[model samples]
Target chain A: MENNNVEILLIEDNKNDAELAIRAFRKANLNNHLIHLKNGVEALEFLFGTGKFDVRDISKKPKVILLDLKMPKLNGLEVLAQIKANEQTKAIPVVVLTSSKEHPDIKRAYALGANSYIVKPVEFDDFSKVVTDLGFYWLLKNQPHV
Target chain B: MDNKEKTIELIIANKKLAFQNQEKEKRAHELVSANKELAFQKKEKDKRAAELLLANKELAYQNEQKDKRAAELVLANEELAYQNEQKDKRAAELILANEELAYQKELKKKRASELSNSNKEVDDLEKRVKERTEDLESFSYSVSHDLRTPLRAINGYAKMLEEDYGTVLDAEGLRFLGEVRSNANKMGVLIDDLLTFSRLGRKGITKSTVDMNMLLETVLSALNQSMTHNAEIKFSNLLLAVADYNLLQHVLTNLLLNAIKYSSKKEKPMIEIKSEQKNGEIIYSISDNGVGFDMQYGNKLFGVFQRLHDDEEFSGNGVGLAIVKRIIDKHDGNVWAVGKEGQGATFYFSLPDNDK
Candidate 1:
């Protein structure tokens, strides 16, 4: 529940896709202290300790943010721009995971300082594998700036 | 001298005086004659003076007439010289006009040749565009074909539900699973159609004499084995076509399959295949007494993913004709169709008779 202890922050609008990603991370034993926010608004609020997360520590940032491109309010790119613009959150690694490889947002995400981009596969097994691999890579393999 | 002589000889003088009177009478007669001669001479001189005056007046009148003639000649000579000058100026203008005409003719020649050169350039550009389009088609073909792997995986996982979770699933859950599987299968078919369509764009034609009779036999038998239909198929004396064997087979398969599919609703479906040689090309036709489409939308028949009939009425992803069109285009051939609603449809394609 505490923001300081969160290692993975997933901002996804689709409940089923979020569940699948969580299951993938759990299967890889990388879901400990994982936080799932339904939209970019909630993700931004949680990151900056505003709104519902007002009492949480603002100094603490997730090890990585898994962003989805298409969302209801405040899309992934906007959230990415905000994250990269802020001095405190700019150093944290952000990965973009979306359904289409041809999505135009992929380039923009990287341009906005996204560390990695992964296309979510249509098949459940491949999707699971990709999510699990990327989770492991970010949480364990990659060295955080903090 | 007579007085002194008279005094001395008075008596002798009487006889001398008679002789002198006689001589004096002779001398008077001679003097009268001379005076008459002188008067005649004076009359002759007066006549000569009057003749001289008349002659002088006539000469003066002739002189005046000559002077008028000389002045008229001088004016005539000056007018001739002015006319000569005008003629010279006209000759100079004529030379300039001829030069201008020659320059215009040369310019026209240059323009005509330039137009022809640009026309040839346009043709070359068109050829290059066709080559580039073929390359792009092949690239997309590979990309779409490679997309099949993930699609297959998706379908496989969706199908795995029946075997793995069949016991725990309710009817609705099973239906949902079926929908997912079917949608994945549909996507797979679409991708395959896209690949086929794109492949036709790049596939080179291998020309060979194909026996239509045998090809139809093989295609019909293969189709029959795959699907059952009470359709009467007919073909006779089919002409040979010089084309790529595999591509020709693909075209026939698509056409025949279309015929069978559309006519399936009829009580007795009839499909006919015919061929003829005309205009240095072999025209092949496939006719079916099926639910034909409206002729208005004929132009869109060969377009990618373009369907005239509803997906519910006919199950097609609409890429079959597009593939046919691409193949025919690659062969430098043409394909067209004629159809009437509820009557029948006939598809025709022509291949160049290079073998002949």
Candidate 2:
């Protein structure tokens, strides 16, 4: 992929959730060069061009990163911090997505430079629509630095 | 004639001289008697002069003794004057010391009464705490026994629907059956959460200072990994707070879940989570840009199975907020929410200082 050419970089851990999100994006017809990473570690490596993702061009940052706040290693907020703190990946819009808004760290994630935040709906239909609409907005409407 | 007369004269002269001598003797005897009388008178005068002299010397001696006595009286008077001044000062000191003793006695009495009153107050407080603990135990028992009976009925009936009628039911019928089962499952979740909440009341809280910032991060990660929400959440100023590490985690998890569920329909939902200090309590709040309800439904928001939104709009048995409220109340805290219809909602909960 060319540098700065990717859109909708999703950093989620659960396979079920990742599949559901991909299906939602396809239904909305907003699927672009969407890349899915299983955890925050992979997400960071992809962005900073390190770890297993060192082969990718460092400059090809995603326009919008949909980040899950929870993952096994280097969870969402830590990933967000690494992204937001670095000048190289600071411009990319990071949208926090989680199941519980009650998670106390939701606020901190935003303070650490999360661009947006969302809670997943338990109902399948609502979840699909939320996913589809959010894909469209962040991927199409949001303009990132080229 | 002269010769004859001379002879006669001589005789006469001699006779006259003899007579004169006789008279002279008589005169001498009288003069001698008078001289003896004068000598007696002179002796009396000399005796009176010696007596007057002796009387004058006695008066002079008495005068000297009076002078000495007067001088001794002046000295005695001066000693008495000095003694009187010393006695006055000693008397004044005694009076002041007596007054001080009285004042000290009054102070000691006051302190004794105050100490007794304070001891009584402490006894009352201890009694009240024991009573409260007993009440919580009974409440937990009620939750365990009384509440579960209804739950068992609902769950049993739903299971019967699927197992017994699976062959006879059509597609839509089966779908409805599925809803019944799921609703029952949801009720089971509600009951479980309620049990957890009530158990918190009876359970002695082992509180330790929690790093809330880290706890929140961990909770958020778990929430995100388990579920998916597309809305962008923005937050700030999440600080470390003191609370029961596990209980607070549960509180945050429930609140955040409610915010996510309620705000599902917004074009672009936004959730904000933060903490603040209020009235000496730690208040954690979650605000969401979602389909909020009217304030009228606010009263029932934290009630068990009390839901404002229809099942079609939001699927919850309304036990989540109740559980949150219970946990907070157990921690000697409070939980409340503020929202307007079609706008956003903010839920606030406060945890009191640790009871340790």
Candidate 3:
């Protein structure tokens, strides 16, 4: 809620998946500035500085967002549509994480301007690798619009 | 002179009177004859008049008969005219009836075409149902992801536990955790195999000329890369197959792996693969000299998750043969197996001889 910059905004409803991703990022030292929102509506409010996050600075946005497709209330695709359609948050790279590689919504996510896509594999090692790699890419490797 | 004259006169007179008397007598006889002739002529005239009257009466009778004939001819002409009109009406009805027959024939032709169109519609409906089936299969594929999510969490947590607290936990505790992780991994494999089998149903087979030798070589090389096997694989006279190459490759991989896996315990593991032309089909067989199964359980050979042997004896998910069966079924082929306990198992699959 204060004036600062966040790196990765992970919007995943599942707690265990979120905890595992956090542990993965923490192990890779990428969780210091990472923000975890439980659902899509909360994520939208956080991004736009509305609702509970109204007191937060709207200009200071995350470098990248890890969006999950299936969620309560406004789903990831809907959240993604709002992000990409808005000029304020559209430049922040949104990498969509899906539970399945063969998900039909992944295509729709991309079509709605998702920067990248990753399937959350069942194996811990694979899930860890995907999380850390995505953290590193968005935080270190990728050049932001700013 | 007087006396002579008188005497002469008297004699002449007397002679003249006698001649006149004789003439009168002759005249009287002639008169009688003439009168008889006149009477006979009158009788003849009367007979002629009666004949004339009779002929006149016959002529009148003939005239009356001619009049009756004329009236009958007029009546016959009217009847003929009425008959001609009736014939014309019948001719008109015949023409109308012929037109009706022609129209009926045209209607029949239209009905046949309509029937063919309806048949086409039925085909379209079948195609739509197939598409919907594929759609549902794809949906299940996505549903499989949701199933794996929780599975991933379970496996991930255990893995995290081992990674973070393995040094603190006892050896037995670590083994228990390992069991949990392995079973989760096994479930994951089952899910994947089920997906693969379901995906096979949705796959549209694109068949081409496939070199079985190359296919076998590819499969063999892939098998070599995966695990170290002691089995001797022998395949000879493998016929060139007309099939979906990738599918055939899948079929080969599953069966060959089965042969190697089952026969791994044998001192001399032998795997034989052969393809031959028989009964308008390209019959392919893979025989393994391994821990074979009983012939009684042969009915469940190609069933999904239908295992003949225990997992402890044979490490299999019971989907290889099922997958092989499905691939063969897609190719309009057959799959069967023959085996006896401790002897061996021979798995056979045949593809239709498309060239023939």
Better of 1 and 3 by TM-score: 3
Q: Model 2 over residues B93-126: C-alpha lDDT tens digits?
A: 8899889889988988998898889999989988
**Tens digits of per-residue lDDT for model 1, B1-356:** 58768666775676578778777777777777777777777777777777777777878888888888889889888988988898899889989999999999999999999999999999999999999876676556345534644564555566556657898999999999888877776776676677667556555678888999999999989998989989999999999888888898999999999999999999999999998889989899999999998999999999988999898898899899999988888888999999999999999999988856
Looking at candidate 2 chain B, the ten consecutive residues that score lowest on lDDT are: B144-153
- TM of chain B, each: 0.64, 0.54, 0.64
DockQ of 2: 0.02
TM-score of model 3 (first chain only): 0.96
**Candidate with the greatest TM-score versus the true structure:** 3
Error at B238, model 1, angstroms: 0.5
For B1-356, candidate 3 gives per-residue lDDT tens digits of 79988999999999999999999999999998988888877777787778777777777776777777778778888888988998999999999999999999999999999999999999999999999987877777567778888999999999989998999999999999999998888888788788778778767899999999889999999999979999999987689999999999999999999999889999999999998888999999999999889999899999999998889888779887888899999999999999999988999999999878
Off by over 4 Å in 3: A1-4, A54-64, A87-93, A136-146, B1-143, B208-228, B232-242, B277-280
The 0-to-1 C-alpha lDDT of every candidate, in the order given, reads 0.84, 0.77, 0.89
With a 3 Å backbone cut-off (N, CA, C), the pairs that clash in candidate 3 are: none
Q: DockQ score of candidate 3?
A: 0.45
- TM per candidate comes to 0.49, 0.41, 0.66
For each candidate, the DockQ is 0.04, 0.02, 0.45
